[model samples]
Target: MATLTHRRIPGRVRDMPSDFPQVPVQDNETSLDGPREAKAFLYKFSQAVEESDWKSFEGLFAEQCWWKDHLTLTFDKRTIQGRQGISSAWQSLAPQRKPRGFSIAGPGIEMVETPPAFVRMTPQMATLDIPFAFSVSRPDCACVGIAKAIPSASSWKIWVLTTSVVSLKEYPFQPLPRAVTSNDLISPEQRGKATPQGLPHFQEALDAVVIGGGCSGLSNLIMLDSIGANVACFDLGSPGEAWLQRYRSVRLHHPNFMIQLPKYPVPADIASTHLNGAELAQYMSRAVQDLKLPLFAGVKVTSNVFDQERRLWTVSLEEVQSGQTSTVQTRNIIISHGFYFNEDCPVIPEGLKDRGKFSGPVQHTTQFSTTDLYEGKRTVIVGSGNSAHDIAKFLGDNAAVQSVTMLQRSPTAVFDFDTFHPFITALYQGNIPVDTADFLFSQLPLGILRDWMGGAIAELVKSSEKLYSKLEAKGYLIDRKPNFIQRVYEDRVRSIYFDAAGAFDLVLRDRIKIAHGTVVGFTENGLIVKDAETEAERILEADGVVLATGYAKTDLPKQWAKSGFLDAESALQIENMGMPAVDVEGEMIGQVTRSGHPQLYFSGYIFSAARSFSRFVAIQIMADINGQAPEHGLP
Candidate 1:
């Protein structure tokens, strides 16, 4: 078997150039030669690619452009800008992968079995997105590509190209072996306990080693296990400890049914749309034990050493309580510190004065589990986000509380979540299979979604005029000025506070007071805030302060390098990523950062990341270890 080092994805993700040459506007209805030209272009395009004709490939693209590949030819999600780079990549992989059978989707080319996928136009960008299907020479691979075309002198030229693996012939997504929801119909004794349990200790060496046992880590673990991969997961605390440690009142922002893990899902019988923190933790823990997943709880991954020559990884684990240590070698390492995504670690603002003079309870929202201790005391909650909103509402609903104030520096956008967001109604709630739902939802390109959503968001924003007028009366600074794209993607969490959180409802009724200002510093009695509009200083008296400020970003890569046998260059090759910002190029970052160590994968951030994107990770790793012999790992 050939050494797998040559398959390394670039360590650093190439940031797409911002100064793109704008496309000249044409009539959206007729600019694109509609399906005819698109079919011909793709037909020739597939021929050129499969035959390794670089010249033809280059000629088909515009002078300046970007090609975004998502687990297709590259088997990794990334965007390549410029004709040269894209051509070079396709030229290298096309021959080995043998990507042929191109069609306008309905052409019914030989070996192509996809439906009539068609061309779509974006009036905002004056670009046409043409979806096509193709076959790969590699066993068990089905590929799809979307080409974005702009007007040229005579016809359309490929501006931005996108390719992805729709499915694998060998590893198709299957329903969980057991019922995801718990069955309560049987009596406790009749149900009977399992006769035995799957061992928690993993084999000394494995195909994949997963770090971080939070939601994302567990999701990945479930997927890899379902596919029969020799995998194990390790975390510093018990499984689901991240959620277990949160406030009791903390509930999921989305519905329980829609927020399904890879295999284990929340029981469908729950009455509320929201699942509180405890319920979430129990579901995660039960999934591990019931499935008998190889999850080593209360263990930390202190070091991970990757060997490019042998294409393996030696991971060192440490027991949190006894200081015991062990090592195991594997072909791949997945870093899924779920909490580290965009919402770093808990951040304590610098301005809080800690002198003995200001003697009152101060805590982050994560720490403020209940209002039992400070029932009659005035409370001021810092930050304006999911946690902050929920905390404020929680405090307001308690009649024992004297007053509750929400301190936020930035503007916020609020909307009825189920009504406003399409995901809740369109794909997740329907009768479609979970696998099909997740795949289709994941495949919707951001470039097209942004254009499609901008107008809808604009309409929604206009309709909220009455809502905004009420919020303004309550001293709330609405996100009146929002970038159409950012409102949906990048600035989504910060700006759009879901109505499910209920902070908005309380504020409208004066139950939870709203204060829009910057916390310049903390006062003896409360925080010193500068009004957002006036810049005038004011002091709000509070018996306690809950800093709902976001979690600070953890340096997981640096932490992993602590004890690993990393060469200087290999060390340099490791990188991590959260959600990429939203834009033409930024949206492509949703794929795991493919640069850095070839054997290392850090799938961090976003709720569904590890689950939604884990199949590719499993596929890539399985591909690497297929023909290779299992080496004696570090003892």
Candidate 2:
């Protein structure tokens, strides 16, 4: 690799109050008292990156920290393994890097939902998403990258960094640098290896078989084994592959504290308080090691058949590494397997299915990652979720990409990465004992009277000109008091606002483009949009298009339902909208497929309906399942 001297590029900075809408730091909530600490930390951290100050960045890590960035699909992306590992990853990248645009203290924190669950543990981790532009050689050549960080001690530090060079053709409207070819980013090995093929069954003689090694499966296995239940758990290899398989720029909305699984805590020394998909997955892997839990990697459970004569559930599995088939019989069956394994890709656009005709490379969000493949192509990303935002922002920095447009169906609720502080994380996980009815009544949009009161209080405080004095006068003594309900409202409100606002700004500045309308259909050449007011359809051209549309629930096993243990209606009873139906009690109305099958249960993401508030937080789901298991006799 050739060494490139680092140069600083000027960019706009966002102004976030050091203590605006501040709240009292409650120990139980894991709140940090003031913004001075946060602001200073951001300043120093930003400086380190700006100047390639590796030592300063390294100094920010905790001794026991773990680093991860799965969303970028850069499984081998830069991570500060331990406090010192920060320097290791950076030193290598520093030799050929340039810095462009810097913004510190991206967003403020807010609580979402709080409910009591099985896990009562306090807040333990925090994470943040930091955005930047990277320049390789000429000043005009820049790419977008994300630095996801978490809180350590009194300051924040980088946990993971994923950058990709983009092209002008991809973002013709944006003022980004030229595109980088696959040779510039992806390694030969990554591109050459075939996607992992399904393996033959592993013929291991096991007493118990567990499917899905994600948090839920891992947790169930740990408990079953602890109770001396002979058990073997399995998931497709890559430990936290799902996280790695996502678009690279994604970050969790909740903090690390609420995401940790039982007996496997988020490391006290994590690189960031918030985590991206990769980091979360890495943490899961570390948990397996730290807990010394027995886990089978690269193993997939193809089927689970129950035998009426044997009075046992037969679990069939395939080991990707070794070509063999195996079956196991368990005294009791625990279905902790989650639902995110398969991709819920949209029905291929009628005319675009034969993508070769479009004369451009098109891909799914599931396969979308860095900008190496997008350096010089015009890109149109479909969908309005976080995945779409990440890809748009990433491609916006490319020079070769002619233009980038993010198509949306409707506005979405967006929140700052910081809103996921450990305390807030707990709140989002619905683990806090706060009243849900009260929160909804007080926080929902219809609660106008309460919002007005909050607004009045805010006005008075602003009038005082001194937040601390205003707080003290109101029998409060904080620099700023976070409007609980307003904060909640802002979380949803700001997501739509920020993305739209940011996209609008990009448009005004000619950095990117935005279109709002209903997608009528897809043509071989481009898309047709129906204008809401004019009711007229307009066609647009593009070099490539990506569906940022969200995912759907995984299809349930046909075999299980075929056994007569579960009825279609009863199954629907468990489904809430696109998610699975879970009771407030976190109980999944599991059906015994065999009709006479013994007590069987379902937990994890597949059980989405009842997991509403805490679905984003895996640890919360684990706690809920553990707490509710006894009621269903799930052992």
Candidate 3:
């Protein structure tokens, strides 16, 4: 094993004209042949990186040209400033390397943009896959570099090369013991041969493959696509249902007017205010339709393989409608499959798993839909969140259900929740100190606070009797007052409010009851609630219990083990409190480490480290995957 260190060769410069030549941007199809153009650019780029040919690499950069390595928000806008600046930067920073044969292992390009001819060359850029090693450094430290090509002096040249490292010791393609899911438990014999080699050719080919339809997967698809890479997206639902699957009762805390797909604006009618589940679904469906995005919907990517020789990814997929298995290949794969893939129902305690055998029906919240499930039964809802409030209110109206009991381990602070622009505006203004409104509005994150204020105002207006009565006469609310600051506020204030801890005043007075206690264990009839404050235990019987306990992070994709992409040690290499590791931009650290492979990225709750503890926000997820945050972090 060797460690990379930058070394300078004294008097390495070959005498040439001091007045630097003006570089040109390369056209999208410079060579007329895409493969040849791709290979030629990659070869030259490798030569420059290995031999410390800074001048050659820099000569390819067009004025104000930028390079995104997929992690950095702002691309590398390297300023040549007469060759010396270029040479100095590379010589002092790049890892020492010796040529170990260079080759274009894969040929795939996603055309980002095509600018007309500029600066004696066409201005265009695409991301391509190339595999190489730093021989002078660690042999095991292999990397797949995503390089950019530019035109300079009648030839295409490599402009920027961002390398992500991969090591066999850390990530292997071997199968481990299978973990059980709700469907079934595994038998040792079923493990069979779980190696990349066992899969048929083309059975596993992917650089990064994403397997869920939710925000995480959609955003990842856009990011991987942005880099001009061929990534396959698999999900059991329609392309956007993952974000739209929330119960109809849900609405985005942020107004639809501010939150939208990248480069595309939301529909005018839909953009005016908060978005509901159906509206969100329509938005995603529209994106898919508008982009004509490639997707394998109603199909789930079940497993994958890491092909070492081809340096590609192979995934095993089951098409739900067809009941058939197929595979796809690529060099990198992303498991944007969401965290809540399968509903994570709470684990009934050892004592409680059996309590169900003694009495009434025991069901988890995932199976819950209406109050009718508890109508006639002695309904007991465990947890203090919004669901409890809704469930209590629902069951209160049922004649069959004797009573609805809510078990709370802790109390919550409730607040008013509304969905109009003016209401948010007024509230935001109210929350601000009288003298600091202007300053606060200017400095707030994404102008979210300002939007809040505007929305508060809008709500106040809509709720007024005069306005409501007029709208009632017209059969709908039609008040549309424009505040010049509304758009500005929306642009600046983009935060969404979630009322997980808000008050539930409507349910405060009712036959429904609230109990605060700890569960010591379960008995044959019901649960034993022990009061920590009183040193006493109470036995309560219920027809059913809904455990609203939270969730724990799971491994990115189950097949990473079978494919030997990650071993136990390497799995631990990227962890945040037991979750997978990720950079500030929400890119899984394993995929970004200088030693990790380029064919991988991550999403879902694993990104909690970056976004304060909120994981599934679709807009934030989109921004991170699109490389919005700085490579290292945000200011």
TM-score for each candidate, following the candidate numbering = 0.77, 0.50, 0.49
Clashes of each: 9, 63, 63
* Residue ranges of candidate 2 with Cα displaced over 4 Å: 1-208, 340-356, 416-510, 553-579, 582-598, 606-635
Task: Give the alpha carbon lDDT tens digit for every residue of 38-146 in model 3.
Answer: 6666567668767777777676554333232221211111112223444454555454333334555432211111111212211232332222323123222233334
lDDT score, candidate 3, position 610: 18
Q: Write the per-residue lDDT of candidate 1 for residues 1-635, one digit (tens) a residue.
A: 11123223322122224323356455555444566667777777877876778998888888877776666666555556678887887777766666777766533322222333224333345555566777674545766666767667876678777666655667654444423223112122221111112123434467788888777787777776666566778877776566767666678876655666776667665456667877776777777766666677777777777676777777877777778787888887887765243334567776774534566778876577787755888888888777788888888888998889988788776665644655344666645545445544554345444545555667777877888899889988777545544543443355557677667788989988887788777777877888878999998788888888875645544543453534445555554343334323454332343435657676655564456567666666665666421221111
- lDDT value, candidate 3, whole model: 0.42
Global CA lDDT computed for model 1? 0.63
Superposition TM-score, candidate 3 onto the true structure: 0.49
Which portions of model 3 show Cα errors greater than 4 Å? Answer: 1-208, 240-251, 257-259, 264-273, 340-350, 356-358, 386-402, 411-414, 418-503, 523-525, 553-598, 605-635
Q: Scored by CA lDDT, what does every candidate get?
A: 0.63, 0.44, 0.42
In candidate 1, list every pair of residues with a backbone clash: 10-595, 11-595, 11-596, 344-551, 344-552, 345-551, 345-552, 346-551, 573-596
Q: What is the lDDT of residue 248 in candidate 2?
A: 72
